[model samples]
Target: MNKSHKYKPLSFRTLFLILGLLFIFLLIADLLLGSVIVPLKQIYFSIFPSAETNETFRTIIVDFRFPKAFTAILTGMALSVSGLQMQTVFRNPLAGPYVLGISAGASLGVALFVLGFSSVISFGVVSITGAWSLATVAWIGSFLVMILVLYVSTHVNDVTTILILGMLFTSAVSAIVSILQYFSSESMLKAFVIWTMGSLGSVTNAQLTVMATAVFLGILLAFFKIKDLNAFLLGENYARSLGVKIVSSRVLIFASTSLLAGTVTAFCGPIGFIGIAVPHICRVIFRTSDHIILMPAVIITGSIVMLFSDIISQLPGMQTTLPINSVTAIIGIPVIVWMIVKNKKFDSV
Candidate 1:
């Protein structure tokens, strides 16, 4: 059988077009549907202001929903791409961006800042805002963990062994976080707990700019490794035979995953499932292992899935919002279950 014809086939262009449309529609819906239910006309005016537009409505749409929607899009794309890279590099169907404990490391960083140093900083009259402090600390923590993981990857020949080390790192980090939480003040603990719950609405326009830049850079790095990733899907020795620089590719892929996953964890909290499930969903939907097709497909599909999750999280007319993490898990778990039952390889998806 022809390689491309091994699995059920669909036109890549048609899938992209449909997913693109769905993404746009969901994005618009996300901006328009919220607790307040801003009218379509009001959303229109908010984007392109008109004299007749209600100022309050326009402000709500422009200042709040727009940024949240955009954050959802970026977070989805970053995580999905990160997961795709990890799976390809590790040759593990279950591998995800967070599988290497990047999120755990970020959480540890936040725990240190919020639980360990928060009281001292608060008492000393230091003016660091909690959001900025958490983001900075989280990024540092994730970077540190990434370095450790990369180092282990270089030393160990077994991918499974590296994965085991990643899990151990996560456990160690979580234990430290628990100890910090145990010793923390009530207020500080509450704040840290809330941050863990995850919120797309929390990102401001300025933070969004930082996140967008990080995600774009990480994605560019991934794009540079596309051919190598496809080669990797065939096995490392095979990839080496094809002249793929395995060590260099691993470093670049790890760096890309770190930047993408770390930034998202810093800004949005460790969103679950999108990273693990989106790539699998893309593979099954597109029926190809080619990174050329899978990369763009995962980006679009992840963005659409996340936009839909965000819209549901908002609860539309209700005043209460669900945690973004919870919503993503609910949406992603079923897909993961299906993947397990199907028990298919990447190339055969």
Candidate 2:
């Protein structure tokens, strides 16, 4: 028996139970810890309204905090799951959703809307503030990149090659965005810059619905591929021997990752490092490579981490909130660095 297993006080079941509980606690904290510090009683009344409930407090909980908290949870889950898929598919511990430049593709789409077309289209489908304009354009850009990657996957058998090509495509898109930014008007540039900083609090309920739908679909696809993912951990040859459909599996994983990562990027402005760090954190905590356990673990852990980040961003007692992207990087980078220093062995995990 493994010594660590022998000495472990909590079984995996117990550990998961604890994590689930922690997730709930963190989620509540996320809702309650904003600048105004809505009381627990008020929050409860807001959720399950009563004659005694304060209408103003109810509005604070329902309108502002609830949406932001839910966005944080969804963003965390989507990014972490997408990262898990990327790491498994490429067999690289460092691989993440951002590695393939899906975020960059989404950024390009937003850049086009904010910088290139903001002044030109005053109305219609591509209008600057229409229902689906920004998010739809972002989806189009990410989907286009996904199509290109899928095409390349069909022709190229090497994962490294695919990664390199994805990077190249990202670089190309980024160059175009830079040019657009250079020519943009001051107002356009300011809008674009703010978008890049990312803000979880900005998503409306309707936008949250769309984001939730996309994330749910992508997560379902990932769940369906759990067996294939485990097989790939060993090698492509081993996976093929076990009857894995390599090409189809890769394409599906890619598509799923693109949807999950792209949707989060579109709404949250490419909140970084959670996707990459959360999986590693789960692997370390759960001590298992099995996606069966890792998947749920990552989901719960990701939500907790993101909620924590959001709470910190709110900076209790202060009116101004910090940019979510900055908080995530600040939290995630140290975890990653510590992981690297402690393990120094990516292949084993």
Candidate 3:
């Protein structure tokens, strides 16, 4: 299948078309298929105004579901791309945003904001009102950790060393979070716990704009590295022989990965499995390791999975949403295990 994979019955163009149509369908379903049972007619008309929509349905579509679903899609795209970049950069199939401790750095930052700064200031004057401060802190921490990883990657020759370092970093940050939790008040502790569970609906329209911008920029940066990334699949020595500037490419990848991992973590908390699982899913489904195809496929599939997760989170007539990470784990884990066992022959490649 891979021999003539490039000239298949459905090309990248067709795959993209299918994904685009699915994206549109999911967007409509996400906005209309929630607990309220709002008519699809109302949703379609709300966007087209002249078609006919009631004020209440319009409010639900415009004010609530639109932002939530948009956030979910953007978050899925961001995490998937970052996972792709991490796999390429480290040359490891299992490398990912959370596995690399990048998300832990984010968690630490959130811990600091929610536990450290807010505790000092008057609660009403600070970010006790919203998720902004926590998100900002997490982004900062992720940036700092990515910088450190980039530095170490340049110095360390073995990829395994860097992976271990990342694991150590995650453990260290987790310990710090534990310490913070021990000292925190009961309310703050509860807030931190909730944030760790992950939720996509917290993003408001303004936050969605920011999140969308971050994901777009990161994706653009990721696409630009395709040549270097392709070269990288051959390992560093061969890439160097091919005149790839290893250092600059690594720096750019670090920046892009950090932006993706950090922003998503900031906005959605630490979403696991999607990062490690989706790229491999792409490889299995498409039967190709080529990044150009894999990247787009992963993005589409990731967005679909997340949209479905969002739908499950808001189960029919449920009073409140389930944690997004929980839903993703439930869906992603078994598939990942199956993929791993089925594709263990990849070790020979």
Sequence-dependent TM-score of model 2: 0.90
What tens digits encode model 2's per-residue C-alpha lDDT throughout 261-285?
Answer: 8888877787778988999999888
Question: What is the C-alpha lDDT profile of model 1 across 296-324, one tens digit per residue?
Answer: 99899889999999999999999999999
**lDDT-better candidate, 1 vs 3:** 1
Instruction: For each candidate in the order shown, give its overall lDDT on alpha carbons.
Output: 0.82, 0.82, 0.79
lDDT, candidate 3, 96-159, per-residue tens:
8888888888888877887886563234123434445545666789878888877887789777
Query: Where is model 3 more than 4 Å wrong at Cα?
Result: 1-9, 50-52, 119-136, 345-349
**Cα error of candidate 3 at position 262, Å:** 0.3
Backbone clash numbers for all candidates listed:
0, 0, 0
- Global Cα lDDT for candidate 1: 0.82
Clashing pairs in 2: none
